[model samples]
Target chain A: MMQEIILGDYDLIPDTIPSEGELHLRVKPIDMVTYWRRCGAVANFIANFYRNPQDEIYHLNENLISTTFNELIENAAKYSTKRDSDIDISLKLYNTILKMEVENICSQKHMEAFQKSMEKIIDSDNDELDNFYLNKIEAKHAGDKDSGIGLLMLKKDYSLQLSAKITPIEGEVYRVSVHAYYNMSVE
Target chain B: MELKAGESILKYNSADQTVTIEGSMRLANLMEYDKVSVFLNDAATQASDKLTLDMTKLNFLNSSGITTLSMFILATKKRQNPKLNILGTALFAWQEKSLKNFNKLWNEVEISIQ
Candidate 1:
């Protein structure tokens, strides 16, 4: 069976951005887990690549972009079922709006869990999201590992529109593509 | 006591009852943040009157790090002894936004952003 789900603002993810304003990075999940620092390094590189010295908000946007990208990369690396497979990350700039997409292979179990979290975020109002985030933090258990706080924090902290597309691959594995749109003009 | 990993540094000064976290922290997962959680929890326990967390120099922190901090805050709230005071700088946009969310966790938490 093949399935696809779009959470929010799926139409905003364009087919392309100008060559000068687009960047793509590919990394294996194994390297991300073994060398944890690679996540920050990749994020910083992409942030720097998009920074414009002429813009007065360069420093602020640089930090914000890096933090956003870092979370996406970390989540992709953590949930991926095939450690040796490549996770593709693409960043595009359309005027003041920045679009980021990350695609990775995950087991059916992981994809289902990810979809549930994304759905909650897209469905909640501002107050509900805040309460949900706080409850998750307070309900932390010793054995319960996945907090799903990264995506929640992004939803709560930034003016980012989030969505994901899941495509069935084989028996229980699937390819999940997560998309995020951030409007720098608002900041 | 201090924990230095990658580009970040976490330090505790018993004399001043302050834990200064500098640089960026992007630890992989919850397990990787255990040491930092322990450090902050220890600092929380040792402070009798007030515990201050200075994050002015911390330019970046991933969600895992934020969760660790939130857990530390909740534990301190449960103890209800050492009042928690977090010192952040408005220079970092995240501090202006995310740090305030700590207040919702514990309203009594005093957050001062300079």
Candidate 2:
């Protein structure tokens, strides 16, 4: 049976936008680890693409966009189920709004984990989200690697609206699409 | 002691009891960050009075790196030894926003964003 799960402000993701700039990148999960610099490289490239010299917030926005993109791409690569499957990334800019989408193949285990994390973020108010983030950091054990702090930081620190769409593909595999919307105008 | 990978540098100077991190750090996973974690832990332990982390030049740190720093702070808090001070640069928006979270983990942590 095929199942679909949508979390967060999925409706806010536009069907189409007349983007001023667009970039698409695809990479395999295994290669991401082998060449870790690719994440930062691609992120800087995207930030430079949208750079405006006249804008007073140029440096800040550049750093912000690059950091934001790096986290999203890194998470997609880290959580992907198939090491050889490609993680697809798409970035579009509509005026001052930046839209990013990363799609990756995930096992049932990862899909559920991703869903649970997204639900936690979507359900929390400002104070609850802040506390949850702090608790997650404090709760880290030596063996535990990721606690979904990057996504939470995006929500809590950057005020980014994040969403995810999970669709079962076959057997225990699924396609997970993570979407993020950032308004560049905000200081 | 120092660890250099790609464009990033993590160096600890025992003389001043300061650890300086520069450039972008997007290490693969927690295991990859172990060396950094160990270096920080050692620095925190060795400092006589105050241990400072000079992150003013560190333009980028991935979430795993952040976790490593947080864990170090938490451990230092538990030990109740060498006071912690983080020197951050205002050039990076992330520093302005995320570095403050360290104080939340340990209120006594002194953070200066210049």
Candidate 3:
């Protein structure tokens, strides 16, 4: 049986990043104006963190770190309440697996749009998923679509396992947390 | 042609037909990325023979960023297709995987990894 989404306490991350196996970062009440800038900085930090400690993971894939980290943060911010809400992001490495989590506040309208996209991902097989991504790219390139392609690439290109939870915190306000896992050894 | 957005720099050298992308590019969405492809596609059509994109220092690229490159590659099927070349580094895992996808999308695209 498939486990349900976890909407419990999502604030268990410590204040600082660990030396060898974990890293965490948080920026609350962010606005769209500065969202891209912030995600770039944190992605570089996480990518370098695992890459610098070469003893922990041989030949660290910094691009993987950057791609995965940025994609999640960007999506979180897009749906986020921008100016007045918190957006939390974290990364942890254990036994050749790197896990990333992002929690951000979003609106009911954004929640519905995002959930529809996620359903396509969860329902498709590898082949179906690939076609869906390519079609999205083509449509977007031709100026006919605005569907975000980050999460699709997260799974197809990076082989990440993605799971998300959207829960209402108040009227018209919701909290969305997406957890992604990347198996470094498999690649 | 050159596009400088904060730390990111996208320089297209018309004389040498090269597009060099350095720093991180995390644009707002695919729409933003389409502008990049439009710029590249325009450059490709004007190229007399060939075009090269150097991503050696481009450490971060969201899917939208890579999608822009793929769109550029697919554009080669057009009548005025220029011989496309991509130069990237292998140390960056994203480049290592993402760069190869270009050839898979359009096999004739020339790629060099250092």
For model 3, the superposed segments whose C-alpha errors exceed 4 Å read: A1-22, A29-32, A50-59, B30-35
Model 2, span A86-179: residue lDDT tens: 8998888776677888899989888888888889997888899879877787777545555558888888887889998999988999999888
Where does candidate 2 chain B have its weakest 10-residue lDDT segment? B1-10
lDDT of 3 by residue, B6-80 (tens): 467888989999989998777776667656777777778778888898899987777767777776776675554
Give the candidate number with the greatest DockQ.
1
lDDT of 2 by residue, B1-114 (tens): 888855789888999999999998888777888888888887777889799999999988888888878888888888887899999988898898799889988999999999
- Please list the residue runs of candidate 1 whose C-alpha ends up more than 4 Å from where it truly belongs after superposition: A16-20, A56-60, A141-143
Q: Compute the TM-score of each model's chain A versus the native chain A and list the values.
A: 0.92, 0.91, 0.82
| Candidate 2 clash pair list | none
Q: Each prediction's interface RMSD?
A: 1.4, 1.3, 1.9
**Residue B21 in model 3: shift from native, Å?**
2.1
Report the C-alpha displacement of residue A77, candidate 3, in angstroms. Answer: 1.1
The per-prediction tally of clashing pairs is 0, 0, 1
Better model by lDDT: candidate 1 vs candidate 3: 1
RMSD of model 1 against the true structure: 1.8
Worst lDDT 10-window in candidate 1 chain A: A11-20
> Which 10 consecutive residues of model 3 chain B have the lowest summed lDDT?
B71-80
- Across A30-91, the per-residue lDDT of candidate 1 in tens digits comes to 99989989998999899888666787652337777888889999988998898999899998
